[model samples]
Target: MAIPSKTIKVFEELLESPQNRLVEQAVESGRIPIGYSCSFVPEALLMADKLFPLRLHAPGLAGTELADNYLSCFVCSYTRGLLEFAMDGRYDLLKGWVFVPSCAHMQRLYDNLEYLQKPDFNHILDVPRKVNNDTLLWMTEELQMLADKLAHHFGADMSDVSLRKAMEQWNDFASVVQSIGDLRKKPNPPINGAEFHQIVMASLASPKDLILPYILDFKKEIEQREGIKNSRARLMLVGGHLHDPEFIRVIESQGCVVVADRFCTGTIPGFKTIDINNDSPYKILAEYTFAKTLCPRMMEDFDRRLNTIIDTVKEYNADGVVLEIIKFCDLWGVDAMPLVSALRDNGIPVLRLEREYCLGGEGQLRTRVQAFIESMGK
Candidate 1:
């Protein structure tokens, strides 16, 4: 049977609105919502007590006119689009905001937010450039301090019990997402990439309690569905800040199956379950956050990141990799130089595309993807 239209519609409707219906409902139910920009922010910590994490994205953003007043044209469109939304009062419902300096662009975004919006409960959880014992200790301390601030400001329950509970809850959600992601590894997977991307975006945007039931139902339906048999080539997407499911749809429209992805909003690491051990919850979060195969902002983790991409490609049986980065993103632009050479050296086909944060230039994107599939001789 084909995938249920109702299941997909639930996620599609959630994505269309600026403030998600579940998020608005959570606010109405006396839960506080906090806005976060990057994956580096430990969301479970934000969820400690009455706080809920709202991963920010500006879907269907048409222009950056207001954002342009403050940020230069040199800024990446993702940041610009977010600023545009903020200027439009799209995120006014959020009581607090947290940020991590994942890159200079993000740092600039924070700077602009501090000056322009002057949010009441804004804090930056400083993450280190390198993963070492010293940095790990620093990270653990930073999280504890952040928890303390949250408790002091919002009367949040950041006690070990609360933190642990939040972590456990997040892990449960991750387990379900992992099961869905594993389905993609099948020789002919039941779910396609665009559908999978929409599911993930909806999960991240909605509170776990509000969205999990719907996801569980969708997962059950997907598991029993027929496998897609018309895919010409399997691809693993690698990049930064790709929250738009339409981008995946465009790629798949060119006759390839996006089997796996390693991006900011992707599953490989983003939805990986945290291994619950006997360590302090903060320490566990610190270690877990630092250990993931993450973006190139981790200066000393290049080899680890490269290996994760290679391993994922093999694990997913992908014939090629499509690495896309938004225009004017310095971190990924610089990282791409070495990554392209390295992946090709390892006998992996790589197609590098640079586009704006908003989805456009579909004809060109289709052309490039078609060429990439042809190059793979699929």
Candidate 2:
């Protein structure tokens, strides 16, 4: 079954909401909302505890005057952007936030957020650097403590069964999205690349149950429409947060299919799942959180991330790589030179575009992307 046309329309509409209403609803109903950075956070488990786990993304702020007052110029641009947004009261809706020790810059941001004169519920979660058994035990204990704090604040009790059920539902949802991603690798994929991005972005904001069916239906629909022509050149998108479907649409409109991506808000973050074997739910969540791959901002080793992108592009038979760098994203900007060089050494052409999270930049991006696709054809 494919997602109904009406459902897609509704998903688009929800994205337009100035404040994340879904998050607002979760908080208003006496549920704690914990914002997290990196893919390691087991947000699903938090949801099971009746807490909304929102991924803390870079806020795409216009100025950094406020952030500069607290942080140094050497800090990563994403951290600065987030600080600017917080200062501007953009994410005032969040009840609390969780920050992992992903990088030195991120850790600094956490310190500032914790001590700064702002909202009362903001917090910094200390995550262990290593992934050993000792660390896992420590993390489990930490998560349990955090859970207790949330329960006390929200006046709600979270049972083991509920947490397990939420994990199961999220696992199912992940499987469905993985299936759709797998389909994109086919010579004649069922759904268009742009449409697939829309589905994925929508899933982030919607409930698991609602998202799972739409994904399954979309897969089935694509299967039915097999044998459709696929003249567009295949490409892999790499860079900062790309949660907006409009970005994908811009690339697709330029006659290129985004076969894979390693963006902060794309497949990299959503690809992993929690292990169900652990008897201790907190332990399971801890292991999942700490063992995941680090993003550009989190890890010093750029080569590992570059190699992963190369592998993904190879697996998908992508003809070129598009680095969708967001302007002022220090991590991506720093990594771009080496990443592009590595891909070029492997005989893959790359195009890098610096953009803000808006639609106006599409006109210039489309021309450059179209030229890249045209070059791939030759």
Candidate 3:
């Protein structure tokens, strides 16, 4: 299915442009632009502060020599790119930085930012490495502290009324992504794999207020259109630190329809929401985020994470699954083989690809994905 020009334009301006339209629009409107590294940073909290919760990304970064001065070359390329951008004055527009943990590189990135050049505001959030009732209490305390810090730092609204309103808007944002994501499950999805991925990338790259209504409108467009997809097999993508359009395009170019995905950048924690009915939204946010985030950083949680992949395979009716991993990214790296084995054990074909942090490695990936799809012979 061809993407609507209007929707395509939305991403082209955000993803392909030299400057971030969302950040530009936020700055021009006199709103604070708060950049964050991990999904654990609550958008609802940022929106409550009237700040644009810009998910920090190093789109189209050419090289990482500058960052290599401070970070070892062994780190994930995505982290290297982020540090390079920061040192090169790329994040000068951001007023604050919020970092949460799932990997060691990000933790060091915050330290490097503090040493080289620090933003006006800096916050490091703590999430438990385990899942239990005690985790809820710990996260509650941490979120409450974060709320207080943000209120003091930005001098913006943190009232119950403001918090509730932010949750409503965030829930609406989730609804729009969920509606579009649901389309991928159709036997002949109305949207192509790369097209839907662009939609997901646009959500993180742009302001939620602008992207929300735009996608809600686009949802109606896809609903009324007829799909024309005839692929060799159904594929599901699962991994981390991936936002490259070429990654999916190359796979699709090989006669595979990417039916579903689970990743930090794609959709996992990104699709989830807290209980808005709770009187204390902070506690709700803490509990929901702690429970739902299934990164490999959370040790001994492999069963839950594997179950999620299996469930996605079943739910999307995927014929095979691909796990995309960035080399040396300890967070997802360790799980690649286990996931491949577990999924294959369940009678699902699995392919694991170790890729670059950026878009340079698609030639090799295309060959493998093509072979994988051809083997299915659907």
Candidate 4:
């Protein structure tokens, strides 16, 4: 499934023009529009119902004032930026919003949008924590309930055939993404970290049909390029909102390849797939919510998180870890010391970089990352 070059060009163009008009067209054409926070939401069901499932990225408007009313002054910049975008009516095209209870801040944001601001259609999906039979049954029911709601709201019945079709399409997208991830496992990965980040970000922002082809093409491009002759130290990136290509570029150029990660924008979203056959989607969601690897702000499981990191480092044979702490992101920042301690205990070095979701600090960040990588050589 090599993606074509033409497909890559089209995807790039679509990203450049992420306008309301495009989303509006999808809605006006009788497709229901739904927005989701995390990538765990199943796109197949949405497609089956003739709806547009859009991953909410930037709201396209400033959220400073709106966010100030709800969140604290020291919250993650990504949260504030998104709130500002929503406040400015950039998400006017959204008929419904799906909030996967990943973090407290995101849950709070969902509450505000659904209850306070009042979007046309709103649903808070409760993701389960642990993966088990009980959780699967519960999740299936939740998906059905969501399907029923959409059927009623859109004045269309959701058929079994459509559901199955949607499931297949969603699965196809997942498979493509998984292939991309597998590529990273290779010793001389054809794709660079920055390019890979861009591809993933593009997939998040657009539909699978639009992004899949581009990814395939990008994979082909990588295969054609000369592979890395000397392997660099492997590093696992941990943090939230790492959609910036420049951040990846800075880190990769410092002689370290990000082989694995647990970031909000990275592995976390792809780790779980929605089981549409659950007896209760809400309960399944709830289980995922509770079982999810809690961040510093969410739970007091630093040891557990540390163990998870250690396991990933060992699994990926990583030489070190990089924690991209968003500036003033209380959760990650607060957990920094313990996370560092845990990594050090396992004889794996770690690097902490604070960022504001901008490229302005790249020069200094690169220097620090280079130093970290240099130490790995010794």
- Give the candidate number with the greatest TM-score: 1
The lDDT of each candidate is: 0.89, 0.68, 0.80, 0.66
Worst 10 residues of 1 by lDDT: 1-10
What are the clash counts of all predictions, listed in order? 0, 3, 0, 31
In model 1, which runs have C-alpha deviations exceeding 4 angstroms? 1-4
Global lDDT for candidate 3?
0.80
Report the lDDT tens digits of candidate 3 across residue range 1-378: 555546666775677632377768777888887888777777777888577687788878889999999999898888898899888888788888889876888898988888888667888988788877788789878888888888888887888788888888888888778877888788888877787788788777677887776787778788876764677888888888777776788888887788786887676546776577755888877876766567888877899989988898888889998888888888787788777888888898988888877777667888898888777776
Ten residues in sequence with the least summed lDDT for candidate 4: 1-10
Model 3 misplaced stretches (Cα beyond 4 Å): 1-4, 17-19
How many pairs in model 1 have backbone atoms within 3 A of each other, for residues 3 or more apart or on separate chains, i.e. clashes?
0
Q: Per-residue error at 204 for model 1, in Å?
A: 1.1
Which of the two, 1 or 4, has more lDDT? 1
**Candidate that beats the other on lDDT, 1 or 3, i.e. the better one:** 1
Which regions in candidate 2 have their CA more than 4 angstroms from the true location?
1-6, 18-30, 56-93, 101-117, 128-142, 156-162, 210-223, 298-303
Instruction: Give the runs in model 4 whose Cα sits over 4 Å from its true position.
Output: 1-29, 39-47, 59-70, 114-117, 128-144, 156-161, 230-232, 268-308, 328-337
> Tens digits of per-residue lDDT for model 1 on 153-240?
9999999999999998989888998899999999989888988999898888878778999999999888778888878999999999
What does candidate 2's lDDT look like per residue over 201-230, in tens digits? Answer: 656654445346666765666666643254
Count residue pairs with overlapping backbones in model 3.
Answer: 0
Clashing pairs in 3: none
Candidate 4, 1-378: lDDT as tens digits = 122234345444444433434555556676666777664465556666567677676622233777788777776666776676677776666777877776677777877776567876788666555446776666667777777888887765567766655666766776676666766767776555555666666666665554566677766666675544465677788886676666776787766677776776675335344454633434433444434434554444566677878887777677888988878766677788778887888798988888875455677988898888888873
